[model samples]
Every structure is written in structure tokens, then in C-alpha cells.
Target: MQRRGFLKLGVGAAVVIGVAGAGVALIKPGLVDGKLGPGARDVMRAAAQAVLYDLLPPPGAARDAALALQLDRLDAFIASLPAPTRKELSDALGLLATAAGRFALVGLSRPWAEATVYEVHEALNAMRVSTSNTRQQIYHALRDLNVVAFFNSPDNWRSVGYPGPVQIP
Candidate 1:
């Protein structure tokens, strides 16, 4: 009888706590948040790829030369990093490159959204860090890159503080 009573009391307490938490979440609009669906992930990947590609110098008769130059610069920088840090940076860069490559193969069905971007930020944080400069540069690159790629596009310009031209014809 005593054990049964204690179990019921415990269950009741748990139910109460659960209900209280739900109530708090309802009362505080920002207390609880949602996550990105798979669709958002695909969009983010596509947007990231587009942003990088757009930032790259245009391919012309100089295409090979430009690529070689960029590769050499990146290789030298990677080599200068400490061994472990280099490996981590390499891994992160490789992952991003892979994603970018995949994006080029099949364009996204939808546009990138803010919720999905949170996942990107989380992944970057997990990837690796070398020097403070590397960290800052990467962070700035990713943040700026994504913002310009996703939010600065024609469809998103208004939300991103872009004022379209006022032309008098």
C-alpha cells in the first residue's frame, strides 16, 4: 500500500511539473523554439554553395590560373597552421567543399531560412579551430557569406537592409 501510494505521488508530481513547464512555455513566447526541417537543410547547403561560387572570380581564359593561385594560397596557409589545428581546419574546409560540390550538382528547391542557419553555425563551431585569426576569419566568412548569399538575393533583399534603386524613367 505504501509503495503504491509513493508511486502515485511521484507520478502526480511529474505530471504537475510537466504541465507547469508547458504552461511556462506557452506564457513565454520565446522560451521555446523549433528546429529546421530537412527541406531547410537542403536550401541552406544550396545557398552556401551559390554564395561561394558567386564570390569566386569569374571563369574565363584565366580560369586555370585563378584556381591555381587560390589553391596555392590556401595550401600555404594550411601548411603554416599547427599540425592538429591544420587537420581540423582541413576537415572543416573539406566538409564545406563537399557540401558546395553537392549543391552544384542539384540546386535547392527552396530558399535558405534562419532556423536552418543555426545548424550551420552549430556545425562550424564543432568542426575545428586553429588560430584566433583563423576562427575569426572563418566565422566572418561563413556569417557574411551566408547572409549575402541567402538574405541579399533579390527575393530577400528587403529583409536584409538593401534599398533598391529609385530610378526615374
Candidate 2:
């Protein structure tokens, strides 16, 4: 097939996504019953490795614990959002949790759990520079959410030299 224009690209992508979604629906990944699930957690864990590369502890048990705390904070933060926002985010996360979405939307050929930080970083960079606004939004959302969640961990406070909130009372 010859190189096509943006409109054709969008249409083709939509078609591919439609077919992929049909298959993904059968496996039931990510959110279920309006709550974040294991699939979403996997997606965020891999993404956090990339987005918080500098802040994260060097790879070890410490890093794993930190990532786990980050996921906890992320769930809490997302849970606090309005219902509609939660639904939208859940849908987005669900899509990214799928193999097709990971490859098509994120350009990551490997499973999220198997993807190295470098691969995840490169995939995120691709999304950041993409012409599609939706892709850009996903990039920003993942990065921002990771930042918010990781920094929220009190254990991580020392990484940025935050000494906790000053008491006013």
C-alpha cells in the first residue's frame, strides 16, 4: 500500500481498532464494574518505570515497593475523580491494557509487563510526539498521573527533598 494522507490514516486506524476491540472484549482486561483492575495496574506499573525514571529508586526491592505504592496512590487518585471522569479514564486505561492498543496506540510490541524501561520510554516518546491529539493526551495523562502518584508517596518525599507539610496549628 502507498503512503496515505491523514484522513485515510485515521479511517484505517479506526477500522483496525474496531476489529481489535472486538477481540479484546472477549478477554476482559483492565477496568471492570467501574473499578481499576489488575490489567490497569500492569499498564501503570510499566508506565511508571518510564515516566518516573529519574525519581524512581534503582531497580531492586525498593523500586518494586515504590512502584506498588505508586499504583496504590494512582488508584486512590483516580477513584476521587467524578464518575464521568473515572469512566473515561477507565475506558482509556482499558484500551491501553489491551495488546492491540499497546501495539497500535503505544507502539510497544512487547507486553507491558515484559517491556523494559527503555522500550516504555521510547514508546511514550512516540506518543508524545504523535500528530494525534488523543495520543498526546494519553502520553500527558500517563506521565502526569505517574508523577502525581509517585510523588504522593511519603516514602518518596525524600527523593525530592520534601519534608512533609509544615504544621500551621
TM-score (all chains, Cα) for each model: 0.29, 0.83
Regions of model 2 farther than 4 Å from truth: 1-13, 19-29, 165-169
For each candidate, the alpha-carbon lDDT, in order, equals: 0.41, 0.83
> What total of clashing residue pairs does each candidate reach?
0, 0
Query: Judged by TM-score, which candidate is best?
Result: 2
lDDT assessment of candidate 1: 0.41
Off by over 4 Å in 1: 1-58, 98-169
**Which residue window of length 10 is worst by lDDT in model 1?**
28-37
Overlapping backbone residue pairs in candidate 2 total 0
Model 1, 1-169: lDDT tens per residue? 6999999998998677546544533333210112112332333343353334454345465533533443333344435557665444433333333333222222212233332434444444432353445445555544453554344345445544568768889
Candidate 2, residue 53: Cα displacement in angstroms equals 1.7
User: Which candidate number maximizes lDDT?
Assistant: 2
- Per-residue lDDT of candidate 2, residues 38-131 (tens digit): 7788889999999988987899998999888888788888877798787667777878888878887899989999999999999999999999
